[model samples]
Target: MKIHFSARTIAFALTSCLFIGACSDVLNSSKSEQLMTNPTEVNITSIDDLNALFDKYQYNDASWDKGNREVPRITFAGVDERWAEGSKSLPVEIKKMIFFRLMTPLALVSNENILREREIVKNSPLDAEKLKKIALKYDILENKTGNLDESMRTALLDRVDILPPSLALAQAAEESGWATSRFAQEGNAFFGQWDFSGNGMKPLNQREELGDYRVARFDSPLASVEAYMLNINSNSSYLKLRVLRSKLRAKDKAVTGIKLAGTLDNYSERGQDYIDGLRAMIRYNKLEQMDQAYLSDNKLIHLTTEK
Candidate 1:
């Protein structure tokens, strides 16, 4: 029998699986006293220290395998106030590492799901029950219409597509100021994602014209990463990005961040300028290299949870 889970249930389960044991170990460590008081801050001294942590988990050298690459690690302690005080290079390095660690897995999972769904759709005769189940599972449609349509399929494809790492990292660095922005420090709001719901963190400078929208907050940097990806995937403004990615996938070409950056004109108020800036950042930082990186299966260095 095929199993199904609600979004909330799936989120809760994933969060629990990723953090429960990790948090417990952190709490039991020698630094537990300090961590209990400031849960968001972890003991990362320098970029070298962070790399050392990642090296422990890096089993394979992905230099040879172009197609089957994975990232060294996915967990990050997150940037704290100390990041702002650290060397200029430190913040940039931390931001880049954290961005890759977060985006790589999300992209991989989304790509895998999209590929699976496409295969299923291509082989099977349209079954309303199956299509409806998929549509509901992926949050493609908020309500079931009891009919499978081309629009629903398009929506599913769009929602299940991946965000290019270069675009994600550039936008993250720009929005969060290399993880030193107040929103990032306080609420793990890396993308400056706005939420009208009162559950989010109120922006200090929110203007009257901007309405009552507050920056969306998250329990961890990973959560912020997930939210950002989902925002791009599901939001109507980014439909062009999805369409572009689909074309690349059809031709078996790598979906690069530089190419996709052009379709992100709607991501910011600056419009075309924002897209240009994203492309510039990607090129300047050579972040396109990260598009090929993936996650490793080795043991991870877990950061303490944010309360």
Candidate 2:
């Protein structure tokens, strides 16, 4: 999965159509106007500092609505360096906070793309050029017939589906044990994603019946988050979740994580119990409030460093 181009180049290509300026202007304006503050960098030197930061950004104010204000983002540098030495609580809290901050931006980006595509589908005729663009963007077959059928519509919707922050947080917590699991600590595999290519960390107790699958390794936690979102958006297993999200969007309703949890029975071996646990985690921790969270105008980048 080596990307040939730099991140800046990819980002510029993605935004050039939406912005009204040269590449440098687009880059500078995004940083200066959209970003209200410098990126907050958190070096996890001690548990006390981490806890204090979480308390500072706690979303407990009843007046705060998902539609009203932007959610702030925080970055953690050298996140994997000190996790093994700390108490379980320290790593768990750190992982939870990281998940909260990371998923907000990803969801916001996905929702924005979904809205743009919906408008395109609603307003424009499905010309050859438009269909080709859609196919290229979503990895669909461009050689197909030009008709915009239900299958094409469903494909577009599924690719643009957004994952709920609460659902993502709960799964991360359950799969990685608050980022203390061996895969997460060693390979940045926050979701326990499996790679059958033998390029990841092997589970010590993987049963023989499960086939030869290793926990996917990532260069950083942010990479893991991106992969997780892509999995939900594009994988066939999560089509039910995408369908549920589409219905909610059609009704102009919010996509709550709890409602979407029922569709994720395929995500794990626990079946109904997994969904119940996710909903329970959401309710017990009041994670529903984060469903409406949006990234602040300020940008935050999570960076990883070598030990």
Candidate 3:
């Protein structure tokens, strides 16, 4: 009435156990990785969460990227007298200056890929496609009038290559301290660019006191960003950078980061030191790792709900 197991069955069972143990996939579950992004990800599952994130974080590129891409979407349409159209994260230690809201996607393309592309393009000559691209950027030359208004449609377009969005964002972030500094809050200035035309918001705690002293201003953050780009495309100092970028594009050459950045000496009179700071910021923050979505002046993420 008692059951008995054979020696053969015992041996088979042991062997099976050993085999399964050796191939212990059951125990060895896939090693899943949890990737952590910069500035940390929060429980921003709603439009309200976005507003809270933007409010809590103050003005910074990280917040800008998160808000623009994740939540309600940063826009420049309606707002108070404050130049804030989108989200901003503050870094108060920085002086009163424009803080750039580094758009992730566009920044990545312009600063990283496009910069490299320029190099590749520079090695080559003016091809139909390349010319088309260059012309498109300089709409006046393209005669396309895609985004150019009537005023800018006739102006000469000089830049022939597209700056990688990342480089642009990186520069903006570095220069503006992640949209948290003083300039962005008061005047929507993000590029640390000075408009000597006696136009712009004056520093709140101006050391000079009572001067038509300069800064740029815009009704909307998008306008400020557009103006900043225009300033770059129009400025003389950036001419070299643009030329280098264009040459790199024309010849299909790789654009050197150092060389390209050299054109930003005017970005700060602190000279090479400023350049060093920017590079350091990019490296330290790994800001270059941000998404490269090109957030055009008019481009707004039309999202009313977060699903």
Backbone atom clashes (below 3 Å) for every candidate: 4, 0, 51
**Deviating ranges (above 4 Å) for candidate 1:** 1-49, 57-69, 87-134, 137-139, 144-151, 303-307
What TM-score does model 1 achieve against the real structure? Answer: 0.69
* Superior candidate under lDDT, 1 versus 2: 1
Q: Flag regions of model 3 displaced more than 4 Å.
A: 1-102, 105-157, 204-211, 255-259, 289-299, 302-307
Listed in order, each prediction's TM-score against the native is 0.69, 0.68, 0.49
| Whole-model alpha-carbon lDDT for candidate 3 | 0.43
Pairs with backbone N, CA or C atoms under 3 Å apart (clashes), candidate 1: 70-294, 70-295, 71-294, 71-295
lDDT of 2 by residue, 175-250 (tens): 8776557777677677888899989898888888979989899765556765777777766788888888888888
Ranking by lDDT: 1, 2, 3
| Candidate lDDT (C-alpha), each | 0.60, 0.59, 0.43
Leading candidate by lDDT: 1
Please give the RMSD of candidate 2 to the true structure: 10.6
Tens-digit lDDT track of model 3 for 1-307: 0112343332332222111101000101111111111112233233244334455434334555555333122332212222222222212321112122324422332233234334433443443454345445544343543443333322333342355444565666665555545676566565766655777666656556445566776554445544555556656667777777666757977654444666777767698887787666556554443333333322223212212
**Model 2: CA > 4 A from native:** 1-69, 89-139, 142-154, 301-307
lDDT of 1: 0.60
